[model samples]
Target: MKDIKDINKATVKNKTVPTTTGGGVKKVIYTLSTIQRIGLRNSAKALTSHNACKACGLGMGGQRGGMTNELDEFPSVCNKSIQAQSTDIQPAIPNALFNKHPLLDFQELSGQEIEHLGRLGTPIYKAKDSQHYCEVSWQEALDRIAKAMRKTPAQRSFFYSSGRSSNEAGFVLQLLARMYGTNNINNCSYYCHQATGVALTNTIGSGTATVSLEDLNGCDVLFLIGANPASNHPRFIHKLKALRERGGKVIVINPAKEPGLVRFAVPKSAKSLLFGGTEIASLYIQPSIGSDIALFKGIAKAIIEMEAITEDFIHEHTKGYDNFLTNINATEWQEIVECSGISREQIGDIAKIYAESSNTIFAWGMGITHHTHGVENVEYISNLALLRGMVGRPGAGLLPLRGHSNVQGIGTIGVKPVLPQDVFDGIEKNFNITLPSEKGMDTLACLEAAYDNSIDFALLMGGNLYAASPDQQWTKKAMDNINFKVFLTTTLNQGHVNGMDNSEALVLPVTARDEEWQATTQESMFNYVRLSDGGIKRLDHVRPESVILTHIAEQVLPDSQLDFSAFRTHNNIREAIASTIPGMEKLAEIGTSKEEFHISGRLVHDYNFNTQDGQASFITHSILRDEREKPLPYTLTTVRSEGQFNTIVYEQKDSYRDTDDRWSILMNPATIEKLGITENSCINVRSAHGVMNDVKVFPFDLPNSNIMAYFPEANILVGRDHDPRSLTPAFKSVNVDIEVVERQPSLSTS
Candidate 1:
């Protein structure tokens, strides 16, 4: 591991350069440069293609045009959209890529380096004895996968999907797996927002966001917690800007003092870009990692003491309020302050903000869900919303800022280890086949089963399972235990190389959403579905995901009762989805109508919930004092840089943090002084699972004893410990000990 010394040394001395504002002149220049590199015509064509934006789940693009959002606002594009578009329209990967490079050589490449190799245009296979992958015919690759799956017990095979696929592809794949006598079907949500789904389901009887895009317009206060939308969801900044302009307050609660969250310039707005920028957070609160529950309880207690609870709404629309109130009243302020690392006055001030607002929306991201108490974190957020009758009303609800474009859609289409009774009945009745009755394993469980050599086959659609998972070494070992593995993707990632060590793996090239010949659909985070009119294929050999999946199904289960051939076209698959999946009946005619619609019964405009009693429930949890256990020197949290999306590193430099390296640890200046370490000092970070060496330490504006590192690369330090209810890995809060390896001389400021 090479050490990066003084990555931000130059930026630290440059007083003229501003790092706080996001999406100003810098974004405009970056967009132009991207378009120039990809060719103006090609970039424009891909951008204007009638498809949903393949970036964040903010619901941009569709029939209204590619640059439009769900609200029909024009010019809704962001850097994430441009990055995804540029990646898709790139030329095909050369055949020599596999022939010249051995598997070991590919493992040495970075995530961005691997992705820059271009799109996968041909099917490739690697036998167990082979050291390198060789191009193979599609028929042979599919046949090999079918043979392996056919020979293995259905229970021994697991299928996983990423958020990149369309609803049609997700629906077809999950249905095929169930009909093949297995229920081991899951998606990437298990790693990201499974906590949000589980907690929301238990509290409000819905697993998705209760408010729609339009509801954001009516919100008076936006409680942005645990999410840094400026980097992850850049398009959301416009909404925040508009809200602030309308006298609405935006409260940001996070561990790090993210510069983008404090202030941001809207790329589309001239005044914002020309001026200093728009103020995003009216009040920014910094809390310790894994301390969100205590902070939420403190806020609830403050609200109760201030006599701000909506007694009538609680009495009529919710249950267990008394118990919840008791839990809040019992929680001491000293405990909240000690655990959350936030002063009592600050907590009271934020509560006062919420109390004054009539319509408030509570939103969060992976920070809240990527913990051992991930589910409880979400439930407490819900509890806060319910305290003021914020849920099941216009402009007032809970929003889980889903990272992927179609992750929520994949879950809605039944890509899960288990299914609801209604979904099971619908699949059986619609397909005229008896579904499997065995309980299935989630993503982690499947990996564990594979580690034990119980799982023989695995199929991954669109995402890098190895890179997205916790404990990189363990994930690779688990995958090695499987006999056969198949990956359906457009480009190569760390998974394609590191995950296929001991298994006979096949990588099949699939068309990107913009490259699909048939029209597809994706559901946004707001429960709204958008139809993508897929354009011409970028490569001849690459096929639509739905087409490839159906072909495999036909080859594997030729005699099965389910008609695999019928799902060849996206329209046919949509029809099947309409018949089986709830709130998707509109999909049957979406192709002809070109009409996008929100899923029914998901949006909570009224007080009625999907629970048996038609009322929401207030759930309470006791804050664990064990979270303060100091076995390690610091509490490390994994984060994505401004230039990265999920596990894919687009650019190593995090411009927002004024750092030009990804393999560096960020700490507060106070912590650095306490530890007697200088900026850019090389160190070894040790975790319970693994150790990272030659990592440079940079001073950042974070709480003392709290540090931050880029994810996936730092994922090696994360263990398999996860939330008991949602099974989401604790990526946000890991105990780590740091040892200084080498100290670089301080930079000379002349």
Candidate 2:
């Protein structure tokens, strides 16, 4: 048998390319090359266009011009922004794409390959028995979708939205769903940051970042936990570097020692990029997977022992401090160390750094929220922040590093399974229609319901639902069980093909946010709304998402009290949003006034919170313990590559990790040695849900007994088990066993 190293030798080398720093000269070259690949003029136009960034939710671009951030800083672009623009500006997909390729053939393509197939320019539909999709007119597609929705029961239909869409589109979609008599409305957040929302709301009476860019600027220390902003949110690296330059401390806590977190070269800084990059993390801590609560408890214990707790803040601005303190004191240090995989000395050292900082910001990503106890993890993080009086104050608070640019906006505009009572009543009062009062299913519930043959129709507005879901086989089966499914997309993804089997599905081509005809608004993670001045359409056949949604609403609910046809105009929808969604009144003037504004009541700069008593509450929880008899010896955490965003694979190689293969797992050398496996050997990784066979293994700088792999590809090994509170699947921590498929000679021994 051929050696696995010979199959993908470049990936097996496991070398750090050009040192450990991220976004150096390589990023500049990549940006210029991307611009060359897509026409320079198109790239320039897209970059300079007045649109919110389509990448992470760090809030870049808008009225300040492209490549600018919320702080009005110029030339703030990153590789993520460039890649997204290049993909958007590509020429329309060949008119004969659907005709030339069968549905089954498309399923064989990887996420990156499908993305490179170019943008979807026309509406296409596949019949249940059809082997290929055929192009259909917009009218025919809308009519068919309306017909299906009209016949289907409201409870059996679910409306889902992706974060890539505009706030106007999200608002209109959710409104249509409610008007159609279903509260089964959800967005992609349920799979990503829903735990952050649930935890923050319960603790501080708000679900978003309490601090803004200004707060980040003034922070004395940043506690970055379970997040790699260097790869996912490159613009955020600038903040870290700036904070470091000002003598601020950065504490990073994760199982893997990410190279970018250690050091990163700011692309905009010539001296930093050409020279050695700026130091980022002052201290890096690695703990066991699924042990965040224990680590946090350790920190809390250390803080209490050192008398670092803010007694005045806890007593006056917060509640439940006494009980929380009791639990922290009662918790034994031995248990904390055993569960966290960190020494007591190290935990105390971390607490010391946080305790010394007068103002600290607690920021996290999916790594903190992708476990069975995801909500508890977030709550514990909040607990630490509250202990230091970090929350509800300037330059300090909880910041969930949201992935998509408009994901926060989507949730803010009522695209959820349940709406707040005020917003629910306001929608009814404004539209003169009574919405369904029944409880609705979330994203997971919707899929499970469909799998059980209880759901008949699904409308997904802009996201790869199949690739983003856990337990790939189960998600596929659930999608197939649905009678009809509609996907509004700008480009092809695995979901377009693999998500459906026996179901009839429609792929509707929609214009991107930058290509829309009407100006739209998007809210950033900081609760700041920005206006995007839409540009000329790249494809004539494609329509705006708002327009399509309004047309479907018109067809589905004709003669309804709400004037659906009027909503086809984006400004009308904005007016409706301003009237319904509290703190969104600024959206009404955003279209004409061109004034971007922040939504009120989200950022908590003062001690007062939105709770009934106007004080933040402390939530206490015992550290999570896994007592189950495990079938696997190692824990697996699914992570995104530097070349990828969410489930979309912009590139197959991860330059930061220096790996050229996506179908590979990163294991600690000690674990590989203990398992009697050599580097570059092919192995089968099995989890409770599924198995991935013949995967190449590479040694990485992860903690012992823990392994890392890229997401979506590794998503198959992730189980359907999710946090009971938030329902977010445990993507970051899973019990997996590796079986050797092929043995390769060790390079060192050879």
Candidate 3:
């Protein structure tokens, strides 16, 4: 066997503007390099197939066409799409290789090295006290899992899923778990976008994006808060560029001043491709971490003072306007300025811009949702939109840019801890199965259950829970307490290697989206559903996810009321989903027609809303005041690098930030000087949860008294503190103190 280091790592060059926005020659070059690494033949095959982009929730491709979006635009792909495709198109990992290393040895590998361990192409089991995993037959794997399930109570067994799977797979998995008599079903969304779901549902009567792709494009002004689309959503930069060309304004609100968000060179445009970059953010506001509520409240107060309220819209279409206005009026300017870290005049200017725009859209990402007051933050965003009557219109609404591609789809298909009454009734009628009415545990609650030794078994459909969750040590310890764990994945990840400690752990290798032989469906962030036409199977040992899920269901429930065999195929699964999930009725024929359709009742284009009162309501929240007075006062925010996805590092270097080291924290030069520290200084960052010892610090452009660190690495320092309303962890607003580490002298021999 070849040593892992013997294989050449893909060389990536940072050849674009320093600390920049998006669109550039570097992206084009990087895309090509990624293709070459996966081989041209594989890249062409995978890229030409009708499959969704596994990277983000934008839904860049489908059976409607290859490299096309829901709008049917050709070549709608980005570097993220190429990177994910290349990762999926690689050859399978053989059993002989698994025999070469034990589970403990795999722990020493980095995220990139582990990903390069090749595709997990077969089912492998680690027996009690076994050092390495050995190959197991499909029947044996199913039987063992089923036998284990038969012994464990349904309430003690948890089923978790990631957002990358198809609607058919997630729906079936959740259905099987419920039929087994438990509602302990949840997906990756709970950790990332649950705040958006809770807050949006309370305000607009809808949890998903309230606008369509057309509305986003037609909006005259876009308020992008707590989102770094330039790095996470590369294709989104193109839309921003188009907005700029049409004289639309983009107001970016984030603590760190990302160069890519400010100005970007659009490679697709001849003018931008040949000359200087296009300016993205017309107005940029840098508020302190956890201060978005104060900033937005200040903006609302200013708008009200200017008498810019849309009275007719507010009177006829919304509730609680008077109370909301009263709260805004009561908020003092001094308190707002001190809390938001922005001047009162600047708040007025932002309000003026929002009031002047006839059409506007409000959009945000994890930054707004990964805080203790995440739900409140989202409510404030909606409050601003309602003040201007920006929602339920042609060119306005709220859009929570989801991270994973089909995360919205998974939630829509009943992969949640609690199902709505209508959805629950629909499922019982359609599948003839009476599910449990008891509320189920969410993702965070599941971890707590495991730690208490209440959970006997856990089946993770996808995602790296160990790395993605807050407080890495706590998560690992909780996972180790589970009796048996199973991971269905395409490649080697940290979860497979270290998430479990018991010998009954199993790894089931499944085909990737583009490699499956059956068609599947995925939902977009805009409530659009796209059918994916699967291509040739890449590995001989691997099977479709639907097949594996069905077989497991059959083994676990010997006499299930629902026809588990019917779900073996994709179309039948869609039929079940269409009948149960609202607005997904079109999904029944999507596999055969290859038609891309939008989910109904989600996109608000009229006065009617899904809320109980048929009118949007103002959800009020008090400005969260930081009462802590600490000597170590810097607030630490976890951020993703341009070359990385969620919990997955494609490249070690952050091309935009010009940093190859992942453990180092990014800080303002002024802040570093004030702290009596210099660039590249080794420091100990202590948070309430834990401490990151001897981490190197780099000077960069960031808000004063704020520091930025890479995620997963910094997740250790984040406590499991979360919003009470929405269990989303506060990964964004962690208070930390930095202490300089003294350097030790070299050894005498040296």
lDDT of each: 0.88, 0.87, 0.84
lDDT of 1 at 123: 97
lDDT of each residue in 411-442, candidate 1, tens digit only: 99999988988988998888788988999998
Displacement of the residue 55 alpha carbon in candidate 1, Å: 0.7
Mark the 10 consecutive residues where model 2 has the least summed lDDT.
1-10
Which one wins by TM-score: 1 or 3?
1
lDDT top scorer? 1
Residue-level lDDT tens digits of model 2 in 82-106: 8888778877777676787777778
| Clash pairs (backbone) in predicted model 2 | none
TM-score for each of the candidates: 0.97, 0.97, 0.96
| Model 1 vs. true fold: TM | 0.97
Q: Please provide, for model 3 over 71-111, each residue's C-alpha lDDT reduced to its tens digit, 9 standing for 90 to 100.
A: 77677888888878766777777688678888777877878
